[model samples]
Target: MGSTLVQRRLSSALAIMTFAVLLTGCGTWWHGDHQSVTIFTTPPDAAVVVDERVHLLAPGTVSLNRKGNHHAVATKDGYESAVMTLSRTWSWWLLGDVFGCLIVFSPFCIMHDIDEGGYYTFDDTIYITLDRKSAAWAPVK
Candidate 1:
């Protein structure tokens, strides 16, 4: 009787462990299906413009899980807008390449800065006010 009770308890514990493992595995599988978008700009410190408006200034990366078409524009206050298109697919590819290069050449890239004193010299203090539509994120239904 005692041995039978112990066996039953062990079996129950094993079943619970198996269920936990299965649940964890399923969660991981579901997570793998999630998609994301990444944004990258040429100058690490350039402002980011979405659509035609400036969203955030300067070199940074942003991620989004939702799907839709997004236009990204990068600009520094004194510089021109560096416009780019981002779809789910394009964003991933472009960002991956950008990050990979950044990682591989970080030291070298960090040594360089946008020349602020050349013929292209524009007012470093000038801040470009981006139009509203360009900076807003609109979800496509």
Candidate 2:
């Protein structure tokens, strides 16, 4: 009876350990590599340029890779252009990667999340304010 009880406990512990290891880098699986970010301007409609490449009209949404920070510029005919940076920060979901890898004694387990850009996140919505240029220099729109 004593041996049987020990075997059961060992089995339970092994099962739990296996489950935790299997969940390593859960953030990579759950969050993926891309996220949608919405941009809204104070004056509503304006042209937005991202990374000096993708062009989107403000009051819009764009899908961005989570691997790095981004730069955005918003311009209107009469308002001074607004520049903003979209920065990436550690995501709470990465805690799963941290804990799971620690349990397995493998730092490599967390690499999956980091390499896949799942360890970071961006703000879902961003608001930008545009200042109107002086009447003398403002473009007539």
Candidate 3:
């Protein structure tokens, strides 16, 4: 009876843990390599554009891929446009998925990995100070 009771408890614990793992997303269960980055500027409220398409205001956050150009442009009415590029590096946590997916519950773990919402691991902050555009001008010849 003692041996049988121990087996039941052990099996119960395993079942609960397995359920939790299955419920967890790949990115949540295993950290990703990139993350969302928040950008802010000195002047504030400037037009922030990325890759010539994504547009937002200063003091905004953007989710960027781990691998891609992070160039952004910030422009305001009387200020010179600020062009900046962010740095992105490989994250060691990306290896976590390898271990998580290796388990028997990999099928459910892979489900979250396939979703875009669960993936974003960038680690960079962007801050820009726009310079006032020079008022002086010369006549074009």
Instruction: Specify the highest-TM-score model's number.
Output: 2
lDDT per model, in order?
0.41, 0.88, 0.69
What does candidate 1's lDDT look like per residue over 1-141, in tens digits?
Answer: 999999999999788655443332232133222333334444456667666653764433344322344567666655556556554332122232234334353332212111111111111122223322344587999
Selected candidate, larger lDDT, 1 vs 3: 3
Candidate 2 C-alpha lDDT tens digits along 1-141? 999999999999899799778778777788788999999999989999999988988899998898889999999999999999999999987788777777886777688778888899999999999999887776779
Q: Which candidate number would show the highest lDDT if scored against the true structure?
A: 2
Q: Residue 128's C-alpha lDDT in candidate 2?
A: 93
Residues 4-119, candidate 3: write the lDDT tens digits: 99999999979866755554555644555346789999799999998788899888988775545478899999999999987655444334445555655465555555453344
lDDT of 2 at 15: 93
Query: Positional deviation of 112 in candidate 1, in angstroms?
Result: 46
Lowest lDDT block of 10, candidate 3: 113-122
The number of clashing residue pairs in model 2 is 0
TM-score of each: 0.33, 0.87, 0.55
RMSD of each: 19.7, 3.4, 5.3
Candidate 2 lDDT: 0.88
Model 3 TM-score (2 dp): 0.55
The runs of at least 3 residues in candidate 1 whose Cα sits more than 4 Å from the true structure, single-residue gaps closed, are 1-29, 32-38, 51-54, 90-141
